[model samples]
Structures are given as C-alpha cells and as structure tokens.
Target: MNKILLSVLLIFCGTSVFSQDTLLTILEEELEREFKVLSKAEVPVYYMDYRVEDETALTITSSFGSLMDESNARMRVLQPTLRVGNYKLDNTRELANYYGGGYFGANQAQYLPINNNSKAIKQVLWRVTDFAYNNAKERFQEVKNSDIKNEIDDFSKEKPTKYYEPPALGSLDESYWKNTAKKLSAQFLGDSKIISGTVTISGSFSRKYFVSSEGASVVQNFNFIQVFVSGEVVNEDGEIASLYNSYTASNEKGLPSFDTLMAETKSLVENLQKLKEAPFAEPYTGPAILHPRVSAVFFHEIFGHRIEGHRLKSEQDGQTFKEKVGSQILPDFISIYSDPTLKNVEGIELSGNYKVDDQGIESRRVEIVKNGKLQNFLMSRSPIEQFSNSNGHGRSQIGADPVARQSNLIIETTSNISDDKLRKQLIEECKKQNKPYGYYFEDVTGGFTQTSRYATNAFNIMPTLVYRVYADGRPDELVKGVDLIGTPLAMFAEIMQAGKSIDVFNGICGAESGNIPVSAVAPAILVRRIETQKKPIVDIKAEEPILASPLLNKKN
Candidate 1:
C-alpha cells in the first residue's frame, strides 16, 4: 500500500515538475500513516536524510612504468533519526535535568546497514523511518507518563520549517570526467620529461533528500572535482621529500588552466631538488616574516581553531579570547572574516560557498574579528549562553553531528609594505635585538593546534621554505629544520606589520569528525618576536650505491 501511494504521487507530480511542495506533500501523507501506529506513544521529533553520490576517478602511478587505474561508482545513503524525550522518571534528578541528563533518555542510530546489493538504496527510507520509530518508542517506555508530558511540552516550543528543495543535477557523463582529467594532467605535466610523478583526478556529484515529521522536506545537489599531482625526490640521507598540488572546483571551468598547473609542478620539482642539500638550523627566536601562504597556515592553525563555538562551551578549553572580547587581539590594520556565502575572492573561486549549511539553515557571513577587535564566534544550533541564534556555521561529515566549523577565512591588512621592505625591517629588528640573522618563512604545509586548557596554548607552523636573513646585509641563506611556535595571545600582540601582497592557501582540514576542504587568504606578516624549536631528525642512513640507470640523469 505504501509503495502504491508513492507510485501514485510520483506519477501525479511527473519527473520534470516534482517541486519541493510536491515532495513534502507526499512525505507528509506517508508520515501521517506511520504515526497512526504510535498512538500509545507520542512522537517528539524526527528527521530523515537521503544522499546519492556519483564518483569517477583516474589515477596514474609509477613504480617502474606508469600504470593507470580508473573507476566509476555511485552510492546512495539514507539516515533517519527520531527523538522521544517526553518519557520522564518520577525521580527529582530526572525532572531537573531535561536534556539527556535525567531518566528521560535520548538515543540515535543509523538505519542503513552495510550492503553490497543494488536493492539497498531503495530500502533506505523505509528502513530508517521504521528504525527511528522503534527506537524512540523503546526509550519512551522507560520514563513515567508525567515526565513524558513535560518533555513533550518543552519540545513543542520550536516548530520546524517548510520543506526545502535543492537545485537539480543538470547532467553528468564520462566525457565530462575524462576531459577534466585530461586537462588537469596536461597542466601538471607541461614540457617536463615523464619523471617520477603521479596524478589523480576524481569527482563526485551528490544529491540529498531530507524530510522530517514537522512538515520539512528538502532535496539538494552538490558537485565536486579534485585533481592532485605529487612528486618526490629522496635525499642522500634516505629522507624522502615530496611536494603536492591540489585543485578543487564545483564545475570544470573553475579549475586552474593547464599552463598554470604545469608551471607549479615544474617549480615543485625544482624546489625538491634544492631541498636535497639544505642544512638544518638550530633553534632560535628573533624576527620573522611569514609569506602569504605561510601566513594562511599560521592564521588557520593558530587563530581559526581557537574561535570555534564548541571550544568556548567547554570549560576545559583555554577560551583564549573569551574575556578579551572587545579588546584588541590583533593589529589595528588586520581584519578577519569567515563567510560561507562568498563564492570568490579577488576573482578566484572559493570552495566553501554553499547555499545552506548541513543543518538546513541558510549560510551567512560571520565577522569573526573586525579591525582587530573580537566580534563574534562561529555558531551552530548549540547556542552558548551569550549567543542565542545560529549563524549557520555548523558543519560535519556525513553521519556525524554538526558543530561550529570554519568556512572561508579572509585575513585583510591595510598596511602597504612590500616584500623587500618587510625583509629590510626584519633585518633592522634583528640588529636591534643583537641577533645574527632573522627568519623568513616562504612556504608551508598545513599545521595543527591544541586549544584545550590542559596544555600550554600554543601552535607550530611548519615551514617548507625558510631563510636566514643576516644583519650584516649578506645574502639570504636557505635553512631547514625549524618550526614557528608561539602562544596565540603573545603572537597576536607582537604583530609588527603586514605587507600589501596576498596569497591563498587551499587544502583539507582534519578535526574531530573528518576532513573538509578549507581555504585561507592573507598577506605577508611581520612579527617582532617569535620562537622556534628543532624538529626531531630521523636517523635513517642513506641508501648505498646510486643506480647507474639513465633515470638518474641530471639536467644541465
């Protein structure tokens, strides 16, 4: 009978004209029928999420000769959740703590079981609904009737919105995938010889369907494409050093051009070769200039993570800036903002733009810091005491709960100092401090930070290309084996100046739940006083006897 009703609704709506209203109507009718069976127990809240993903990948790997691997796959996932908190215990402790603390309990479980068959996709909705209903009932039965009534009354305060419908999946095909792969590969290969390198191109198109018992339904689609190129050179000491570049786009046209990527790859290879003989430096602290890319890492690891709303809620967190709000945390010339609605910056497309967040709320721009003063915190539905509404910053991986997460972080500076001036200033500062040389961080890999109160609140900014600028006006020397480390508050206070040029760093960030693509943009920055620690050196001995093969041939 349910199948018959769904089929009838589909036929009535037609494939091309199936709007959000039509989908919601169908879901409402189905939910009403299911609710009749739960007359003995009241349903407090329920939600459903359905997602379909189509993926294609092409990979080239080199052990001796390059081997190609390609795959095309699609998958659909369905999740339904129901909450019944109305069942209350007569115990005073249970009545006092309503949200998961009392005798009234809340539980959630995934309805979709692991399956290899095609029929698994079709069973998602039915299975999830059944599971949620059953799970809610079991919990409701444990509580007293009076407590159940009180919990239901509390849950009734907020009403869910109308159904939401996402944009349609226009078209997708193999040709589109192949062409994109070809373009990305050609860009990275350029005129260089086929040295030891690998290229991987992958893309996904995801469609989502969401429904709730409170008359809310939504369907949306998201598209993603990524291309990655990696190459490595082993030093005489058997230290394997590698470089990688990745490009992500919502559509094919937004990706970097072939020429641009080829140039980057060539440059990466050259840098790796240079690093083969680079010497490590002893730990020191004086003056340092962080290039735009390095500055992005500094900001993301140091500042961005510290501002998440969940961290503020945890008493264990340092809450570095909680009391410092309305005070100057950064230089007057610096301004930072995070906006999910921004599709581009300085004509470059941003990967963080999205119409709605994971929790079905519209995305908005969050002014994290305005002209050096702390402004607001990224918020999810979990409101802190001082913050009441959601700014739609909540995000998470599929099947994970959402929390306040960063989007596109833009660090703006009003200073007009150039790269040369920044270096000159660093040298002057080194002279004043009676130091032999200062540091310049030209490039970086990503970094991490610990914001909890248990440990010293500090961050380590890893540098790929670091230099020592002598106070005697001698040539800048390339050095390795030092990481930029400092306390956030002290570092912020020591920010001496910023440069005019800006650079963008794009990559994936891994946290509690999973990894997500994030971008950071900033200009070169100068800090008066910073510290570094010696990176632990590996004791691997160099492999003996260079191969006499032509693959070892060096360029003139």
Candidate 2:
C-alpha cells in the first residue's frame, strides 16, 4: 500500500551524505538546541519530541516484459511535537488549524539534510519547533472555548525507554533489484488472454532516531524487501478485474526463490483468466466458509479497527465494543490479540513487528479479547477510562501524528477443526439455511470498514477469488463479483467453526494517522450466515484491444 518512489523535490541545500554522519548524533544535538530556546517562552514548552527517519531505498518496475521505471535515492523524514499546555488541556485534540488539518502538530514533509552544516540543520529544527508550539497554544485556547464531557485525560504518563537498534539486514545494490524485476515481469509475456502484467520490487534500509523532553531516547533500524506481481483483465461485461501476488521479507535471503516468484506470477495470470469467464454472482446472504487468508482480512477490517482506544473517545466513532468489555463479543471459543514485538511466527518474518513505537514506548502485547469476551483496547499514550497506560500500539507514518493502531493481529480459537471438517460444517449450514450453495472466499485483494456513527457501522471486504460450494457435495464452481459485507457484531456471532492451519495477510493499513504496515494471522472460519453484495456496474464499453500488443503480430 505504501508507494515509496524516490522524491524529486528541489533541494535547497546539498543532499545528506548519510554514511558519513550518525543520525543519533544529529538528533541529540538539535533536540538540545531547540529545547533550550523553547524553554524560555511565555507559555513554556511542557513537552517536546523529535523523530527522524534516515532511509535509503530502491524501486524497480516492469510492464509487459519490458522495463517501465527504476529509481534509487535516500529520504530523511522529520517529525517534531511540542506540547505547550498541561497534559489534560494540551495543545492537541483541538479544532482544525488554518490548514483544515489536526491542530496537534504540523507534519513536515521534508526537512534539512544531514550533510548540511550544523547551523543549517539547527535552523530547520528551530522553525519546526516553533510551528509545533504555536499550534499547541491555539489548540489549548480552543479547548477552553469548547464544552464536552471528557472523562479521560488528554495524555497518559510519559514513558521512559532507551533502545539502540541493530544494523539492518545487509543492503543489496541496484543491480539485484533490477534483474529480479525483469525475470518476474517476463512471466506474463506470451499469455494470450492476459491483458496487462506488471512486476515491482522495492527494498529499503532505514534507521529511526527519537528523543523527548521527558527523558526518552531511542534508536531503531529495520530493512525490508517486497516483490509485488499483478495482472489485469477486462471481462465481457465491461468490468475491470485484477489479481495480486506479493512476498515480503526483512532481507534478500528471506525472500522466496526466483522459481517460486515465477510460479506465483503464473498462478496470478491463470486466476485472472479464470475470473474473466466466471459467472457474476447474485447478491446473497447465507452460510459461507472463509479460507484462512480471507479470514485474516475479515477479522482485520470488521473487528481490529473498532477496539483502538482513541476511537472510544471520539463522538464520531461507533464505539461498538466500548460498553461490551465484560461481555462476549464472539463465539465462546474465540479470542483475539495484537502484538508488535513478535518478529516472526513459524519462520515467517512479520512486517508489523517494531522494537519501539513512534512515541518512544516499547512494543508490547495487548489482549483485546480473551475467550470470546471483550477485554481491552489497543492503546497509545492517549488513554481511555479504566485504561490509563500505553500498550505500545501508538503508531504513525513518519510525518503524521501517532494514534492507536493494530500491529500483528492474531486470531486464536480453541475449537479448531481441520479444513475438511470446516467445509463440511459450511455445507451443513447451507442446507439448514435452505440455500442452494455457500461461498468459499479463497483470496481477497483488500477490504475497508466504517466504524463511525455518521456512516453504517459495517465493512466490505473485496474478494478476487471466490467459489460456490453446493449443498449436495458437488464440485465447487468459480464465481465472480461479490463483496463480503456485514455488520461487525452480527458477523462475529455467526462464526461457528475454525480450521487447524493458520494463514497470514500482510499490508499497510491506513487510518486517521496514515498508512502503517500491519499483519493478520488467522485460521479459516465457517460462518453459519454471511452476507454479500453485487459489485457496482462499470462504464467501460466492451471492445477489441485498441492496439493489440504487437507481440509477434498475433491478433485476438
């Protein structure tokens, strides 16, 4: 979900020569300078924090067996937060600022380069510190003008944590990424029915430095390499359909072999071809079986987002689980939790694991549900009633303000049956419900949910590969065009069985703050009843290829 291409914005000064300078040294030097100046203000800065990301990245893309683009560069992201008022009535959670964005802080998209002289870097820090302070003051005044019953404090106690990260997995130069992209993209060539195919490989190594007025200092580093392959085809009904296959790892050695990537690309092309001829599904509401991958996304979209602590305080949020903490929100055998400290599970590296959160709090495990009962919420420094401490889930996308977000969400169940048993249960439910067939959600592209009171408290998960399982035990048939839609509470209660094998889905999840990487691990589930809706009609007219890909002058 994060498209990190090299930024070409004009530079006012020379670029940062990263290897020559230590990022921590620059951060400590600036934090001292900015704090000294801001300490003398009339209102005085009660709290201040500086966050920087020094990243080097490479991106390579190819389409239809030819190179499309390639870029490599470095980026340093800057975030500074200065709170002027007390913790309860700070310069945050205030009315919108002049820019119609949050008043808590101004996210600086670009900052001074580390290669610049000390004086130049200090000047940039001073300006950013000043900007944060002014916004804080405005928000404080607005808080006094407003009247809302706020039961929870504005901020929780400051956390003191110190951690120096290990060096990232070794960085590979540009040649490696370029060659990989070429081979992966070539798999789509010569496939007659595939309209377009593309492959992209992106890799990055980055270190984050953070310091706070509350005596917190942290340095964390990480590296990642991702290969994404996708194909697109238009159906006879003038609808666009697409499929994706992605692999992620912390280093080159962890990535799947070249042969595996080629096979995956071929599978994606074959699936898209099948979808092109699959019959469109009618809107239906009945029993369904979610494959492990589908179940992972289902729980993420319909459940994980609702229990973030900050959402409970917002009047705009639905607060579906707020008062249900002591009650059962799912079947008696099910439970859910989120843990950011887990680096890997069963040898698979997780993209969501982080040593420390953006707010300098060490990552921890949070049990949101225990044995089907609601337990707690994912928390940041911002607390809610009965939960006044951070559980290390406060996260952001570099420049944006931090909020409570899910990390590595894990869904567990004690009543786990084998996949064969789960499908048997699905067929039984379909027959009992008097439906002709039940759906098997095999693979999903992505999905979204709404937890606001202003909109329906529901979710819609987009499915790319779906099938119909007959009640009489006939062979499953591929189907096209249906969205998994449901209300959260109802859907949770409908689940009756789970599979033994677990699967994981990883991507960058976007919320009020920004997009942050997340993962969901779950077993397949059998729901007695589930709902789906027909895809909206597209306006594209059916026709022959405008200019058939002149490959060997073959015409469709």
Candidate 3:
C-alpha cells in the first residue's frame, strides 16, 4: 500500500481543483455523519462502511481488418453497507431488507457521477445511509423473533491497516490499439474455411477507496491490458469449433512485438484449418491427459469454486467442501494455494494481483491445501464454521458487493514428471483400461460449474482442440465434439501424476456478485479416469453451400 499524496486537481472523481485531497475528505465527512446518527438510533447499528470505485476504460475492436466499436468512458459509484445486530443475524442475510425497496433497492450501489460539488456527493450519501439504516433496523427485529441460531457469525471483526495512494491518470492512445486490432484480424481474410474472425484490444485503469466506521481506510489502483484474437469454422459434422489466443500485459511495454503476434496468429489459423476436417469423437469414459493451460482451467472450475466460504452458509449451494476440510480431498502429491499479491511469475504478469481487497484487508498468500488435505476456505468478511476473518479474497466488479472469489490460484505437486513421461503414462493407463487410445486436451476456451443444490454437482469443460493418442504407437489424430466432464469429488481422486513445468491462465470469473478478474496457474496432469460427453450438434447438414469456398467444398 502506498501513501496518499494530495494533488492540485481532481480530474476523475470530481470536476474541481479543490477536491484534490487524496485523503478522501468528502467520504470521511459523510461517513462520520451517518455513523454518529445511525449508531445511536432506536435499533442501534453496529457498523457502517462506504466504498467507491473510479474506473476508466477503453476498448477497440475490429473484424476482418475493419473497426467495429470503440469505447472510452469513466464512471464512479458510492456504496454503503450498514449493519445491525452483533454478529449472528445482520441486515446482510435478511430477506425483508431486499424486498421492501426504496429508490434503487435496500442494497445497491449509489451513483455519484456528478461529484463536482461536495453537497451533491453528501446528499446522495445521506439518502443511501438512511435507507440502509432503516433496512438494518427492521431486519434485526425479525432476527430477534426467529428461534434458529447461526453456526457462524454474520460478520467478521475488523482488521484494519491504513493505505492510500493517488492513482495515475494514464493517457490512452486509441488509434494505436485500433490499428493493432485491424492487423490481427486481417490474418484470417484469406482463409476459406474460417467463418468468422475478430480481435479486441482492451485497456483499463481503476482505483478503489474504502472507509468504514470501524476505522478501516484504503486506496489502491490497477492497470490491465489484453489483446484477444479469435476465429472459428464448422467441423465435418456441422459442429462449431474455434481457436482463441490472448496476450496480456501490465502495460504496452509488456505486450508482444507485432512480429511475435503474427506468428501466433499463423498458428491459430493452422489449428482451425485442421479442425475443419478432423473426425468427430464418440462418447468415452477412460484416461486422459490435460495440458497445462487446460489443467489450470479444469482445477479452477471443478475445485476452486467449491471452496469459497460463503457457499457453506447459503442453503441453495452444494457445499461440496464444507464437510471435507480435514480430509484428504485430492491425491497425496498435490497441494494448492492462491495469492493476489504476486504480480508476475517467470516474466508473465498475473491478472489477479492486488494490494488490498475491496473490504480494506491487505492481500496475502493463503494456503488452501496441504499434502492433499483441505486446509482453509477462501473467505470474505462473511465467516463460516472455524474461519471467522477475511484473508483478503473479497472481490467484485465496480458496482457489485464484495464476495469471496479466486485470485492467483497455483497448484503444487511433490512428484513431478516430464511431459513425454506423462503422455506415456496416460497410454499405459488406457491399455490397462482396455481402451485403444486416450484423449489429449490441447486448449480450452472456458468452462462452467454448477454448485447449487438443485443442479447436479458436476462440471463441464469445453475443449477447443483434442487429439487421440493411440496405445499401439500410431500418430495422434485430431478429433472434435467432446466435453470433459465429471463429479468434483471423483475427479480429484483420479489424479495420476503432474508435469514438471507450470503455466498460467488469466481471465474474468462471474458469480452471484459479479465478474471479477482472476488467474489460475498449474502444471499438466494425467488423470487415470474421467469421462467425456458428445456435443449436441445439429444432425442435419446444410442444404446448399452459398459459397462452396474451398474450405467448405471438401464435402463435395
């Protein structure tokens, strides 16, 4: 955390030179006023917190060498979280507060876009604070009448550390990115099989400020840049298969050179071409090898989402890991952890790095598993069972409330083998299981998991490229139309081995709260047993090809 330095003008938050104090004097004054009034009300309030986010973003997108959209905007929001009751049942878990809505709702971010005048900012804060206080008071009364008691506290005790830093207002060169995206998308113009091609260049700079009645104060900023290249074609069986490559950096200096990007672009076209003629895969249940990138995504969706502390308290969630904290949930050689403090590893900048979480707690590395045994859950201020304090995992989008979310997830292994050895081991397992060949997952676009009680406790990860490695020493054959799937508990037990090298995946994760940036790092792993289901593609073929362009005319 950096110290705040007052500037001469407030360019982003407010439109005046006098509103330049990095101390957030406007926020302090409003919070102090509300705390003094609400804390001593008929139904006394225990805590009240205020959060504000100032985000400035620019996006440039192109398709087939033509600019599609360009956006440059700035936004700011003020949100107040007021609570009643000691720790058992606060305004947070109450149903009445949300149903009896006022202006926006009992719980919603209050917009303060016109912050040029101090009175305007304070006026919005006063209304928001008053509504929240009333909701908390009514909810606390309901809690007193109920007989059920909670196993864990509604809120964790405050652990505050002073932090402040004036964010940098970086000037963006939009024309540069606009041209870069055009160049990347132009690569697919000459390809006949490619159905669609697009590229998007995105950059953002954001700063968050937090102050609570409990004496917590913080300010921090982040910079993010990403370039995405994507294209796709229908396979022989009329199934859509695509290839995507993303380049991430902390700034323009970290981005790959144009020549380097072109090379990657060439590879993407070649892979998509192969998928055009590749045979469709049949449903199979056997052994498989997940590449480093695919494995990172697999563990992230299958295991990481289940360990969030808030899931245990929600009656609608699956709560898969709630009862297995002390048990061996994975193979003996594997351990996993998450750290948002790490910005770069081996020259690659991570997306999940942060100084302090949205709730004003300093980010730190948390050990989630030790020797395959579950250790602790990813927690926000909301506590559950044995864990009662935040470990800096609370995260969310600008206008959403904070929740426990994954950060820079890293998977560790005590026993590691080479990539070649891992593949050979997979083949050996396939033969033992009486299967002719095993699947090798090359790349994954994304994945989703279902943790709600009503849905099946399963995960399905869509793969972009997969090949069959024969057990009898034959060349690997490309295939399509299979999705990796299994139950979390069973899949964790089938881990056969892990590779020596590590790779990282950076993306955004969306949950009940909102979409938050995250990263997953891990090595390739061989799973002894798993299953794949065929994609439900349209069985009928196209009646006639409008342009039997060489790529699609092969069926003739």
Candidate 4:
C-alpha cells in the first residue's frame, strides 16, 4: 500500500498494540477488501475512499474574575464515500431543476474507537462502506433517471497521490491556561460602563488517515491554539456596543506570552469603552479606505466565494465570474491567488495551510487572477467546463463531502503606496466627489455573502471599528453602527488604490462543505465610491440587569 512512515520510533495514544502508522495500514487493507467485492456488482463501484480524523480538543473560559468552565473532549469520525457509475456520470451528479441544479447529501459519519485497535477500526469501516455503497447505487439510479442532461463530467480524473507527515501530539498545561484566562478576563472588572467581559483559550489537535481505491493514501496532522477576548458596554442613549479581538497560532509555543495577552485584553476593553460613547452613523455613499485586515475580509466574502469551482457548476449559483473569465474583473493593477502551501505570511502562521486536501490530493498554489483578469477558479476533484482537474482546493470538516473552498486568499497590486498616501488619496477622492468627509474601516468581526441565484448576489461586511476622515483636515472621528454593503461586481470596480503594508485575517469559513479554517491577506485599499448602512441598535436600558455584580457590590 501507499504509505510514508514518519519515523521508526513507535507512537502510542491509547491502550492498543498498534502504532499510529499501523492505523493507516489497517485502513488500506479494509478498502482493498471492500472494493474487490463491490467491483463485481452489476452497477459497480467506480470510486471509493475513506477519511478518518482523530480529534482531541480542550476549552478554558473565564468571565468577570471567575472561572466559567474548563473541559476536554476527544472523538474519532469516519466518512466513507463510494461513487457508482463512471466519472462522466456518477451518483454524486446534481439534478437540474427549474430553479437550478444543486444537491447536498450527508454521509452520516460513523464513530470509531480512539485506540489504534485494528480489529475495532475495521469493523466500523466495514459497516459504513457497505452502507455508503448501497446509497451510491440508489443515487446513481436517480441520476440516470433525471430528465435534464448535461455534458459536464460528474467527477474529474486525478492522479493518485501518496504523501505523509508525522503526527504532532498536543501538550497542554491546564493550570497555566486556566490562570491566564482568569487574569485576562479580570481586565474589565470594576469598570461600571462594561456590561459583559469574557476571555477564552482553546487548543485542538487532529490526526487524519485517508485511503482510496485508486492507490491514494495520506496521513497528516494539524493543531490550533487560540486566545479570544471580548467586551460589551452601554452608552447613555441606551445603545449597547460590543467588540472582540483574537490571536491564533498553530502550536502552543507560537501562542502569545502572558504580557502580550494582558496588553491585548486591556486594549480590547479600552476600545469597547470608546465604541460605547461613539456616535451612531447614518447611511452614506462616498469614498472610503479599508484597513488591510478589513480589505482581506472584504475580498474573502465578496470575491473569493464566487470563484469556488463547484459554484460555477451549480445552476442555482449566480455564476458571477463563470462567463467573466478572460475578462477584467478587478483593476488591472490588482491580482488575486490562493495558496494552501503558504504556512505563514512573514511570521504569522496561517490556519488554512495544509499538506494535502481531504481528497488525498497534494496541495498546491492556484493563481486565480492575473493582471486584473479572471484566470481560474479554486478547484476540487469535481470537474467543471475547461478545468478538468483538482488543484488541491477540495476541503471539508470532519463529516462532510469535500468541496472547492478558499485557503490563503492573497490580494496583491502592482501599484502600491504607503498608508499615508492611501489616506490622502481617500480625502482627495472624497473632495472630488463633493463630499464633506469619507470613512475608514479599521477592523471587522466577520461577514457573509449570498452566491445563490435565488438571492440578491450581495455582500455585507460588518465592521466593528470605523472612523470618519474629514476632508477639512480635522481629526478623524470615531463612529459606530456602520456596515459595509455592496454587490460583488459593482464593488470590485470601485477600487482606487492599495497600500504597501500587507495584513492577514485568519478565521473560519462555513459553506456547503462545512466550517474549515481559512485566511486572507491583502493591503489596505481605497475605494472610489462605496455604500454603508446603519446596524440595528440594542436598547440597553430594556436589557440592563437590575442589580450590580456581586464582586463589585462587595465592600472593600
């Protein structure tokens, strides 16, 4: 079988005679046995694969000087997939309807033993593989009976990949982390304006074992360490405002020190205090500058999702860029690409980096756009017109089918200027448009987009911190309740310029596949004309607690 041993040293997790690599051997053996038997069937199993992930996670949280909770969890999930019929037409094909062609099916993940017990593992795999095979046969019949027909192939032919990386174990000092959370959360204590404050730290590690009938075997491992601090406050007008900041790393050593965490928590509290008293913004449309972090998220939501290969195949999708290929989508100076092979930008670790996608395909860099022209879409094993192969973009959570998703989406520009120059351009553009002032989007929490044909193909970016840059040369004014809203094509045309400093935004993206880690990198950008709307106000008076906190009520 196709396997790469990390080392000769024996690795043990639980009470079992088998080592970690032994698990992959067992998986390959079971896959061969099942495929041999199923290939003889009348319909036949054209393709089959297994993805098993062993995950161990821990969470520590604190609020207002008190430990809220501490917990640890572990589990193993197995996702089995078998396709009936050939690559041209398979059980996974989408059925066309009046609205459009789109279908999502779940393969109910099976739980397996945590220990490396070959016997127990095989038993679980045997049951799931049989179930999946029968389901594939039934779906294949449905596809054959569909009234609509399409020339696009149901799946793409990809060369089998054999790759492996040594498993990385997780180490946690519970006591140290628990105390860190408590200290960080205490930063907001004794502040009367604050309504809520919380600090949390989480770490997770997963070891994945994959095997396919086409001679593909891959075993990889990843880990995440995150520290999050958030705070909320109420203003005199009874409008409540909240803000948050987070730090992420791949390993425990990469996590920030206690001093850094404390300083960040302090800054988060101060920002929330200012946000509470900031004036509520009104709807406006004019020039604006998006901070590097904000710009990264802007592209991720507005442009990145539309370029996913599967979306172009689905009739239900807007297919915004499907026909726009070879056409100018952004300014000639701007270009875009997604690289899962990028582990870090500078020294910051990217959460989206991976050695191999869930499909057992080796990850590679995909240049999606060049010189402002649409070049390609992020592809998976599913083939669309023109693009017949996967570029290792297929990804999914533990229990879902793999789909084309973004990794490290990097937006670059040929013409770059300093942040000062970008801001000056924003003011000049605002004056040219005959506006009194423009806005600066400093940071964002997160945002979403709609790519389906049934909806308006629009995007809304929720910015937590915003500033009104005055054209009259006055000090920038902080403001609240501003949301960056616009359509994809219209918004892409408004780019005026970009800054020299590049920033990174790392977060999780949830879609048809599931929630997977992702990152976006871009420099600050100036938009010639953009729109904004007001966020809903929370009536703090109605929601205010009737009593003070016990910790504060106690006499000194």
Q: TM-score, each model?
A: 0.79, 0.92, 0.90, 0.94
Question: Tens-digit lDDT track for model 1 on 371-433?
Answer: 899888877654454565567676765655556788788999889799889988998999999
lDDT of 3 by residue, 1-556 (tens): 1212221211243323223653367887889888897788777788877888777889999987799999988878888888777766676663323332111233558788544578888888898888777876776676677554455677777556557666575545687778878988988876655777899888887777888887776767777888999997765445667889997877888888888988998889889888889888999988999998899999999999998778777766789998887899988889999999999878888998988888777788888999999988888888777777888888877666687889999999987899999988999998999999999998898899999877899999999899999999999999988899899999988998999988888888888767888899999999988899997667664333466555335566
Error of 1 at 342 (Å): 0.4
True-vs-predicted CA distance for residue 255, candidate 1, Å: 1.8
What is the C-alpha local distance difference test score of each model?
0.64, 0.80, 0.80, 0.86
Task: Kindly indicate the candidate among 2 and 3 with the higher lDDT.
Answer: 3
Each model's total of backbone clashes: 6, 0, 0, 0
C-alpha lDDT of residue 48 in model 1: 33
lDDT of 2 by residue, 71-157 (tens): 888877788887766777666663423332234354454565856466766777777777777776666677677774665677777
Among these predictions, the greatest lDDT belongs to 4
Q: Which pairs in model 1 have colliding backbones?
A: 86-148, 163-217, 164-217, 164-218, 166-219, 187-262
Q: Write the per-residue lDDT of candidate 4 for residues 363-466, one digit (tens) a residue.
A: 88888899999988998888888888888899999888999999999999987898888888998998999999999999999999999999899999999999
Model 4 regions more than 4 Å off:
1-20, 97-101, 537-542, 554-556
Q: List the residue pairs that clash in candidate 4.
A: none
TM-score of 3: 0.90
Per-model RMSD to reference: 7.7, 6.5, 5.5, 4.3
The lDDT of model 1 is: 0.64
Give the better candidate number (2 or 4) by lDDT. 4
lDDT of 1 at 84: 51
